[model samples]
Target: MRVLVIGGTGFIGQHLVACLVRAGHAVHVPTRRYQKGRNLLVFPTLTLFEADVHDDAVLERLLSETDAVVNLVGVLHSKPGRPYGIEFERAHVELPRRIAAACRKIGVRRLLHVSALGADAQGPSGYQRSKAAGEEAVRAEFSTYSEGALTIFRPSVVFGREDNFMNLFARLARWLPVIPLAGAGARLQPVYVRDVAAAMANALENSQTYGKTYTVAGVSQYTLAELARLAAKWSGRPRPVLPVPHFVGYAQALLFEFLPGRPLMSRDNLDSLKVDNVSDEAMAPELGVVPTPLESVAPSYLRGGKPDRGPVH
Candidate 1:
């Protein structure tokens, strides 16, 4: 299979590209920027296509040479120039809209999309709502294409050596004596990166999974506070977890959203946390892929973990 992976330069995208190539698929990773050399290099089976995916002409041309498309584009944070609509809606919703249209135009049928676990089409937060909208577009437009060929996988917070969630927290825990908390009671099922890549690879290879939406999560669930404790312990910081009330957290989010750097926590993220980031029981038997536990994979990338298998050496 010839697979065109959008957002292949990203964290999960990197893993997914490798997985697809290992599975005997010819992979093409398209990027917008053309740096002389990148920090991470693509595999031999992987080809690089340099173009802005948001550009309809470019994406359409790229689709011409591919049999299937896997969309891995998403952003958790928004900035002045890059709003949620551009980051999430365009990448999530509108890109799918265009992809579906292009696929129809080019006669490319198969597609596998990565959607977050808590996505709700009618939800309040921009992130969830946009993801849900994207899924909706794919189902409505591409479900019947080539007789029901489209697979959507909703995953919880994916953790691995290169994950942003755990890595950022670990970096913070390393320097800070105390960590601020928002929505401490919020729960998350931290799935592994390789597991997600495997799921994507499986979906792309198996035609039986088409037109199905699968929810993937870790073996166990943990609250935000518990996640903090685990991060502190794993990162070897053991800092005090400072609980910030909802109001306070929101206030801080408001300020940080406008700040130069990425916000540690944003109001939209807090709102997203209001909903549990775990798989629903209904989706359990439907998809039928048992998720790998965080405990099994955390040490592989945790700070001061087993030698040659963690964030630190």
Candidate 2:
């Protein structure tokens, strides 16, 4: 199968590309940053097109030769001035709309979209709402298809070598005497990055997965406090897990969003945590996917200290 991946140079994109290549599929990654022969290495059956995906002509041209597309573009939170449209709406909402048109014109078969667990088009957080909007657009565009044409994989917190979540906490554990937690008691079920890649491959191959939304989460749930403790234990730092009030965290996020570059946290991110970031059992087995335990994968790259092997309770 010839697969076109939008935003395929990102963390999940990189893994998804490798998986598709290994499965004997011809993969083309259309990305803006990974130019040919410039710091970016090339792979067999994995072609990288350096161009803006928002351009309809470019997207159509790329879709012409591909059998299917997987949209992996997303953002956690946006800067104050940088509206959610570019970060979330463009890739999350508009891109799918354009992709659906391109697919219909070119007679493409399938589309697998990666949406966050808490994504709700009508929800509170702009990030989640935008994601939900993206899903709705894709569904609305493809609902006419005879084949189970679109699969939406909603993953909880994803953790990997290059992930911003666990890695960021780990980095803080290494230096900070105490780690501040927002929504400290809130729970999350973090899915492994590799598993997410696997799920995408399965969705692409399986015809029964169309028009279904699957929540991909880790085997177990953990609170913000537990996550910090686990990070400290894994990093061998054992930093104190300090819980910051939600309002205080929001204030801090506001202050940080004004920083020169990407802010550590944003109000949007805080808003997202209001909903539990865990997978729903009803949707898991139907997709033929079981959540991978976080402990199983965390040790590989996150091992910096002594192991803590026991139940959280």
Candidate 3:
């Protein structure tokens, strides 16, 4: 199988590409910069192409050579706007809609979209609403097209070696003296990134997963504060997790929005925390994946980690 991964050079996408290649599938990755994806060349069955996927012509060309597609393009922070920000609309909604439409046009069959767990059309965050809209658009397109299946995985906050969620806390513990916790009471179930990748790779051609939307989550749940303290302890810092009021958190997030790079936490992110990210749905059994516990994996990574595997040249 030749799989075209739209955002294949990203953190999760890299793992998925390697997983697919190891399983004997040919993986095609598109990136704007060839050098940016050069690390992926280490995987024998994976090939990288430099192209802007948002272009209709480029998308059509890629679809022409693809048997399946997995879209992982997503933006965490976007400038605020109505419905959602333009960045969110383009990456989350428009990109998925385009991919689905191209898959339809090219008669390509399988599409697996990785969306967030708490994605809701009427949700507080633009990220949630846009993600929900993206899923809806993809489903609409799939229905119109005759010959394929669409599977969507809405996973809770995914944590791993390179993941933003756990790593953010780890970094905070390493740097900050006192960790001021926003959304300290918010509930979250964080799945391992590798498990999420494995589930997607396993679902590529699985008939059971066709047209099914699976909610992937970790084995246990944790409050934001609990997880932060764990991260601090694991990293050998063990800082005090100070739970702040919503007003203070909102003010901090607003202040972060003005910082140089991407905001540490945006108001939209706080809005997302307004809802619990835990799900009762069991996807590990459905997808033939054994859910990995955060306890087993997070400690090593939070600490310096037992030496990482070097890139193969």
Off by over 4 Å in 2: 35-42, 79-86, 146-148, 282-290, 304-313
C-alpha root-mean-square deviation, each candidate: 3.3, 4.6, 1.7
Error of 1 at 198 (Å): 0.5
Give Cα-based local distance difference scores for all models.
Answer: 0.77, 0.77, 0.89
Clashing pairs in 3: none
Q: Tens-digit lDDT track for model 2 on 1-313?
A: 9998887777777777777887888988877766532322445777776877789898888888889899898877654322354667776788888888778777887888888888876666788888888888888888766553888888888887667888788889888899998888889988877778877876788867877888887778899789888877776677889999989999999998888788888998888778777755643544556666777657556664323221010
The TM-score between candidate 3 and the true structure equals 0.97
How displaced is residue 228 in candidate 1, in Å?
0.5
Candidate 2 matches the true fold with a TM-score of 0.90
Model 1 per-residue lDDT tens digits across residues 149-262: 788888889888767787777787888889888888888888877777777777786766877888878888889888887877887777778888889999999988888787
